[model samples]
Target: MYSRISTVALLARALSDQAESYDYLLAGAGTAGLVIACRLSENPKVSVLVIESGPDVRNDGVVTSGNFSFTGANDRVLSYRAGKAVGGRSIVNGMVYIRGEQAQFDAFEKLGDSEWNWDSLFSYGKKGERFEGPDTAQKTAGVTANPADHGTNGSLTTWKSIGVNPVTDINGGNPHGFVSAPQTLDRDKIRRSSSAAAYYKPVDSRPNLKVIQGNMKRIIWANEKKNRAVASGFYAKEEKLGVKVKSAMPGVGENMQDHNAMVIGYGTANTLVGDTPFATLVTAQDALGNKMPVLAASSRSQISTWAQAASTYTGGAIDAKTYEKRFQIQHDLIFKQNVTIAELFPTNLGSAIVSQLWTTHPFSWSSVHLKSLVSFDDPVIDPNIFSLQFDIDMLVAVARKEQKAYSTPPLSTFVAPNQVLPTNATDEQWTAYVQANAGNTLHVVDTCAMLPLDLGGIVDSKLKVYGTSNMRVVDASVIPVELTGHTTGPLYAVAEKAADIINNDS
Candidate 1:
């Protein structure tokens, strides 16, 4: 019977043939799930199965950062904007690689001294990073060589942008005055090609490793006398595959949440020269056969590139020399100067820059829950985005700060003397403008939080679900607290640590 079945057959058959039984069944091969799957399958003795809710992203242009021109959503592979894709949001993520501030991790310890404290978790963070990019710049900017800060050897490839238009000055300092964005991309600058590419691809050849494509609706529960569930699996629907429970093991889908975001757009007079368009800069390239200036990018990368475009078009000057002078002045007049430091990204056209001011650390909370028992349905995501008043107040403050930054001395002469969004120019006017155009940060987290049992937590200190024996939640959903920087880096670290935990336990 085994000989009759081809290797091209279903994962169920492959899994059945490989081992008498597999040790783990991972669901939702998103950013975190894939990491866990690969690590657990590393053992020659253990067998693992990874059930993805979307299709394969092998050559999908939309999922590959190299194909920056393909702006349309890839419904076939990634589950972005409600599409059933395999790579999950990583397929369409901004790919902004950032670590949580030391204080943020320390704060978690203060909040109860859980296993995820800065001291205990730092090693895991180091294990997940694969830092690349120019060493001098990364070091001078406090990016590399700081063993206390950065990780050199890890699975997820993190580095400064390559193929990036040179914005540097003669001194070779950062052209934009700030550190280059550490992106969650490969050495090639491809987005969505995360640990999945590094771990899953190679390991897929292993006899014990099985990766399947399907939707994940909910956890199938196996009761043990009482109503309390004992074991679990995924409930999914496929056209030819039909409805089935691929996972013999169980997982809990209880805890869920996401970070809130708001973007600010500023207008420019000319077609400003920047990286691409929008606040979230993922990928950008000049139009083929024409350098006159046309950008193609995913929505996430558009934000920063668009902002840079705005800067160039509106004539907001930025270069190494200018920023260096500004930095020097600010350093000398530390307290004296009213500095409003912020992040900026350039777009391709160089016409307009969408100045995005996200709250970064939102005080409000929300969650994602299952809509029904069936697989292939979207989850009920109630992010309650922008519900908190503090978030709004922060955005307003940031707007005022941006206005002042552009209005300051040397910079003022270069940048236009008017507000691009609210022409009238007041805090109130800025707030109104922001309210109408602000959007999400896409850093969703905290539904399946790892907290102490007394704190209404879903997972334990080790990331194992509280009620279940073998079940664990390792994605961003399990993060108890929001980080100061973007979530991708920290999440990768969490997944790496989770892998160690699962491997040791198994």
Candidate 2:
């Protein structure tokens, strides 16, 4: 069931006999694109075509293996990483699956998106996952799950790692405490269960669907002068195969956003052991402990500063009032709601423990635009990490707390006596260290934000571009807000809901 059209000649021949126009044309065969294509192709009447930049790397070890390297900019300002294969970042990311907190989704509802609350979107979450029960060893280690919260039949497979403690369904209402979450792995639990494997492979045999390996040039617009623009098709370039195909769609590439992360690495004397890549996960309160109030106060005091910084970053695209409101929403999530602010990854490197500290969210904005019309030219991506003062301050605070965690109890007993990176440094020195060493977590979203057009929204709630008809952006770019967990879990849910919307449209 894996039909890969790697050559332009084969693709051209495949499309020559078919209708000139397809019922649906997807611009990227990555995470969101694959899900949308699979669901839309369910109906035999519809013809779906997906154009992807990368080739069919289904068996590429660099992509399929859990220990994969990054490919993107590593400049002083920001270090951005994105996958160049069919499954996108899913094939390269650390497979930790977290659905995020309920409060985060409720915040989306308050932001003029009534249909995006936790209750409404929870089903989509279940629809895309097939959860496996924890084994005897895992259950003995305190693993727990609620059967009602998991999906029995779904494309994606998930299971808890061995020797990890689990809480009552991490997908349920609360994810505040320590819990061992599931990962996107196959049944054998060796290879990664990427979107290409889960959603695309199962339905590749359908004659109605075609996946072409190529790069999308730009969205072709039907009417540019109209109040609401309409799309016809798009131009794609496949240089290796020497093909240039024009497919349909407008509002193709516009909005782009990425999660900005600061990694605080600590060298420990004792080797912290774990079968998987990550060992323990600490929430904001868990990491900060008694110092939680300091963060809350800091968040409150920086409301105006945040608003001004965001407004400036957007070039006044977001008004002062809207910026203020957005800051307030983020503040409430950080302070009142008590969402997950930091994630800790403990790894044993030979004789020392290298613990990675990541800030869950960093408030910064940037975009991705084509530098040239050529297919080989990479798109210009600017995440603008640490553009705001608040982001730096938040990351510094989290790093300080992570230092404290390494110094305490069971972990401290195992770790080395002396510090590694900022050894016995002052607060100012630690801040400088963070600025110099912090890197992104590779969870990018909200470029094509789902919101009202008045608020710099490129796509509607249905994942359809505002000014276009019959064209939708079903990628991580549509996510307007950052989630407490990884991007993949929520992205699957978003794509699932998007497919439902596209099908239900009259």
Candidate 3:
């Protein structure tokens, strides 16, 4: 008891005397957080401190085993499906390395931030990667990669997957056709390489970097008037604390988006006897490894898409001109360039793998709102799934497309006659099926979007939150637009660019 008391007292005194401030103080030491923290502290003259929401959880099963042997997302590792660790989503997420469609980033530039486009971000994508091509034996097993499209050396490592054969180079500004994608994996270590493993650990010994665990209550703002709102520091309630500040922007938690699946199951003739059934599943080993999914992959190949002026089909009341300008880019990308818009995945069903078709760009939107700012409490997340008619119409088109492709000659032979969701069903039936079966890809993004302040945006081009100078949100939440496949690749690019922007600013 005496020893414990002494330790507590020492810790209190240490914190009270701790330098009182840092050059940079980040709230969450997650995926993007860690990346920025590492980059800023690189300057020996600067000091950085990170306050992580969860404990370090360095070697915990949730962080290490999720890649190799850990099977369930809601199983033993961590009960909740979200990343509740120091490394954030990178630790818990399946590390598939696929970037966003070129058009999506270009659309970001269209939304008034000319600095944020595919060309600039493409370089950062390569900057954060250390890709290793497949070996001769591995190539024979179906793994493939274009050496030019990948970075030879960087913080994160990616390599070929034996899941599918290649049709084209996916990372080279366009990802429309068939391609064997890469994963953020440490081939030498034979484990899933998370952001923590890739970007944080090597620089852990840096004297300028300090990491802590605590909840960020709010950004402490200066009461005095200024041109832009300036935050003096951040506040956290470790014990008894209280503070209230009303949010200035209504766009803070709105505009969240996620991918939805339109599945058509079947009972296929189990050929190869006991051969493991494979399909394009999102992340499963089975979200990439061995399970059913939210995101998908292939032994299967997915697609490209186009959108028309269909504002009447929208779910929420958004700006009409804003909606048209955005959809115009989607249409242009389809006719002018090669960009993946939807995906086709195969899922395991005890004895067979079902084909699932979903739109990469869904019109539906949702929010994750905070009810209180004074306490450390979980926010309410409202996922308005398939609330938009445009998404369902696209899924219907996708189902019809799936039916047409499979019912043809060579691909038709593999598709069994035991209709689970009946591909021959009418448009009405398809709509009903879409409404009843629509599910998440777990590819949620843009809650704290990176758009100009004039367009209902939460953050500016530099990734600094609007209305506040020092408070910035760097995470999957800051992605202005959602990508087509696994969201990890584009997220890294965002962090890398943010680091450069921060470095340039300071």
Index of the highest-lDDT prediction: 2
Mind giving the per-residue lDDT tens digits that candidate 2 earns over 1-506?
Answer: 01111112123423342324576777778887888889989999878788777788887776666553322123575546676778877877777778777888887778777699888888998997888867786666556678787787810011121112335667775665445567787635467889998998888999998888766654555554355555566556333343333332222333244544544344556554544333244455655567778867877787787767666666665665666776688778776777766665544554665556566666665666656545345777666666666666666666665566566555565565444454466767756666677767777777667777666676677766665555577777777778876899888888898888888883
| Whole-model alpha-carbon lDDT for candidate 1 | 0.48
Superposed model 3: Cα runs more than 4 Å off: 1-19, 66-80, 154-166, 223-225, 238-247, 262-320, 330-338, 347-351, 354-356, 373-377, 400-419
Kindly report which residue stretches of model 1 are placed more than 4 angstroms away from their true locations once superposed.
1-20, 66-84, 135-148, 154-177, 187-192, 216-229, 232-257, 267-348, 409-424
Instruction: For each candidate in the order shown, give its overall lDDT on alpha carbons.
Output: 0.48, 0.65, 0.61
Query: What ranking of all candidate models by lDDT puts the best one first?
Result: 2, 3, 1
Worst 10 residues of 1 by lDDT: 1-10
What is every candidate's alpha-carbon RMSD to the true fold?
14.6, 6.4, 9.3
RMSD of 1: 14.6
- Model 3 Cα shift for residue 475 (angstroms): 1.6
Q: Worst 10-residue stretch by lDDT in candidate 2?
A: 154-163
Which sequence of candidate numbers ranks them by TM-score, best first? 2, 3, 1
Candidate 3 lDDT tens digits, 280-332: 21211211223112222211112112112222323333455555555555444
User: Which one wins by TM-score: 1 or 3?
Assistant: 3
Error of 2 at 119 (Å): 1.1
> Candidate 2 vs candidate 3: which has greater lDDT?
2
Clashes of each: 51, 7, 20
